[model samples]
Target: MFSFLDKFSSPVKAMLILTFFGIIGSALVAVSYTVTKAQIAANERAVLTHHLAVLVPDNLHDNDLLSDSLQVTDAQALGIAEPVTVYRARYQGLPVAIILNVVAPDGYSGKIYLLVAIAYDGTLLGVRVVSHQETPGLGDGIEERHSNWILSFAGKSLINPLENDWKVKRDGGVFDQFSGATITPRAVVKAVHHALQYYWEQRERLFL
Candidate 1:
């Protein structure tokens, strides 16, 4: 008994129309998310793999470093405000090394983020400064290509460097500091030492 326009003008009919569209919109959003979720995860994994390879090297690890990641929350030990990710690398089902995400909070201008790779036997694989706000020419030498400064830490461990000799050259340690930049190197050295201390403490749980 109702006209088409009359039905549309009814409150119940209007409400029904709105509800129908809302359900359709929500279904579309769900479908879109389902379709894109795997790709997003893959992209993130690829990035993490590349970083792990840079610090630990591809041939050295047979297991998936991205899948073997753990989060540790020790602000004082890591020098960061938030938890840091640790990537474990293994060879032939045995632990080879671990890459620790570290932050040097006392850099010359600001914080310096680093990736430190250390073998299970306590050998230093490498130290990479991922991000820093240090001086362009001087403090930036902490970067591998900037100079051999970063490479100097490659073979060093707590035993090799000796705990008391972990400071910059100006502080009478074995590592060098840029001519005009001591604070940056000092902060990095301290952070590396702290990372070594942490690994020594958590080696058992970490390898498990």
Candidate 2:
């Protein structure tokens, strides 16, 4: 009973109606947010799992990669200014590989985020471009969807490339640079190389 509204002036009644609707709307919004939050989180987790799987295959790791993560920060080596998450994968309680969220700050357009998976013994399992703003059709070739260039990092290591051959082919290394777009690939190559070096320096601590 809203019969009490009969005693109020028309304007007051209108105001009261609006206020009631406002409260209801607010409540509905809160309920919707509460209801969708978990689903949104689950969707995000699913997407992350897919990305992680791309670098560290599901068959290679038995442990929960999402739960087994470490925070690492090495501006010079990892090219990140702040702490970044490193997802660790294990099989039968033994280290399988680590997926690092690395940043290449010198991309042609801006910074490039990468998912680099390195095995326990410093071998690279895979590398994926998570995000980047490189020029379309050129620098964007660093993306696996754009080109298979990123896949070249698989199975590589600091020693496999001899440390001196980590740059793009244009720079006298083995990696290839995109046609007419060298800066983007160069940045990614450097970032991946640094990520490997960081892994080499912190391999023991990374597993623990």
Candidate 3:
């Protein structure tokens, strides 16, 4: 390799070596991505299935939540700038619940992702924080692992809390906030409420 390079100018030799390595690097990257693509997708599906099970549960629905999904787009109600996936759970051909992948754009640090499960008749089956960047000990309470606060949304409906009382206690609502954190819970509450409203507006279309 050095003997061949010595025949050419130093700059040209270096350029050829750099170009050769670049192509090799690019090929390796492409191969790696192709090899891992399927595994990545499978892992994502597994995580999503786990989240859905936590919200809808195994006994609640007989249908496959992963397969029965629809895309929904509602910037205002769902707070989604782009269309998001909604997983539908059914039992014996009847709608059991619909899980919306909602984004709370007003989270304290940034947008908070949520999986909101609403029963066929607008009752909230459960709500889970899929991901968020809220503060560690405070705002992170919205997570089920961090605190049971997320479970409070289960069995609740828009009418149960009343439209006016959908905010955190600091905001004069029924829900409680962390000792030093309020924005995280408030944003989640607002997002879940919007998800319920979105389901109400699209209930008929969703099941179809």
Candidate 4:
């Protein structure tokens, strides 16, 4: 009886001790994550805002647009993979630009996430890929480092997408398509066209 008590008691105590430590460790991790959450998100936003400035190329009078979050479904019947958020920026109380999420799921490798900004008059201010699963060398030109290919969309309006204007040079569009990189550019062009169509169809919901 004494031997049994000794053996079982130690195992039970050890388990209790381990359980306590596990609980404490989990709590600490949760607390740390909670405390740093806001700061980390703010830092991320700052980086994106800087990128937006590069895309938009206008003096930021203020950063108020970052604060104005809008619902995606309220304005349009977004595709399942649509960007998660849209923000409307204002200059001196007037709507200057809109920053919205766009996703091109037809990317050769997978979906490509984008942040697109357009002026009230439907002019594209800037476009930045927020996330993508495109091939490394070829499709990556959609990124800023490879080339300014995506930048071609800037200044274009929905009124003039010129689906005729939506191809790589090989395909005879005003833009240059990558060598051995047709699908990626095609997906991007289609996504941009969709975004424009969304803006055109839902202009009232967006502006109001």
lDDT of 1 by residue, 1-208 (tens): 2354364657877777778789999999999998799888888667556767887878888888878889988898799979889999998989999999999999999999988999998888888887788889999999877888888888899898898899887899988888988999999999999999999998989888
For 1-208, candidate 3 gives per-residue lDDT tens digits of 7787889998999999999899999999999998899889888778888988888889988888878998878899888789999899898999888999999999999999989999999999999887889999989999888899999999899899999999989999999999988899999999999999989989989999
TM-score for predicted model 1 compared with the true structure: 0.77
TM-score of candidate 3 to 2 decimals: 0.90
**TM match of model 4 to true structure:** 0.78
Provide the lDDT at 91 for model 3: 89
lDDT comparing candidate 2 with the true structure: 0.90
Candidate 1 regions off by >4 Å?
1-48
Q: Compute the lDDT of residue 175 as modeled in candidate 1.
A: 85
| Tens-place lDDT digits, model 2, residues 1-208 | 3798999999999999999999999999999998899898888678778889888888998998989998988888888789999999999999989899999999999999988999998999998887889888888898778889998999999998997899989999998888899999999999999999899889889999
The TM-score ranking, best first, is 3, 2, 4, 1
Per-residue lDDT of candidate 4, residues 18-69 (tens digit): 8778999999999999889988888888878787777655564354555676
- Which candidate would rank higher by lDDT, 2 or 3? 3
Give per-residue lDDT, candidate 3, residue 100: 93
TM-score for each of the candidates: 0.77, 0.83, 0.90, 0.78
Worst 10 residues of 4 by lDDT: 74-83
Best by TM-score: 3
Q: RMSD for each model, in Å, please? A: 5.3, 2.6, 2.0, 4.3
| Candidate achieving higher lDDT, 1 or 2 | 2
lDDT: which candidate is best? 3
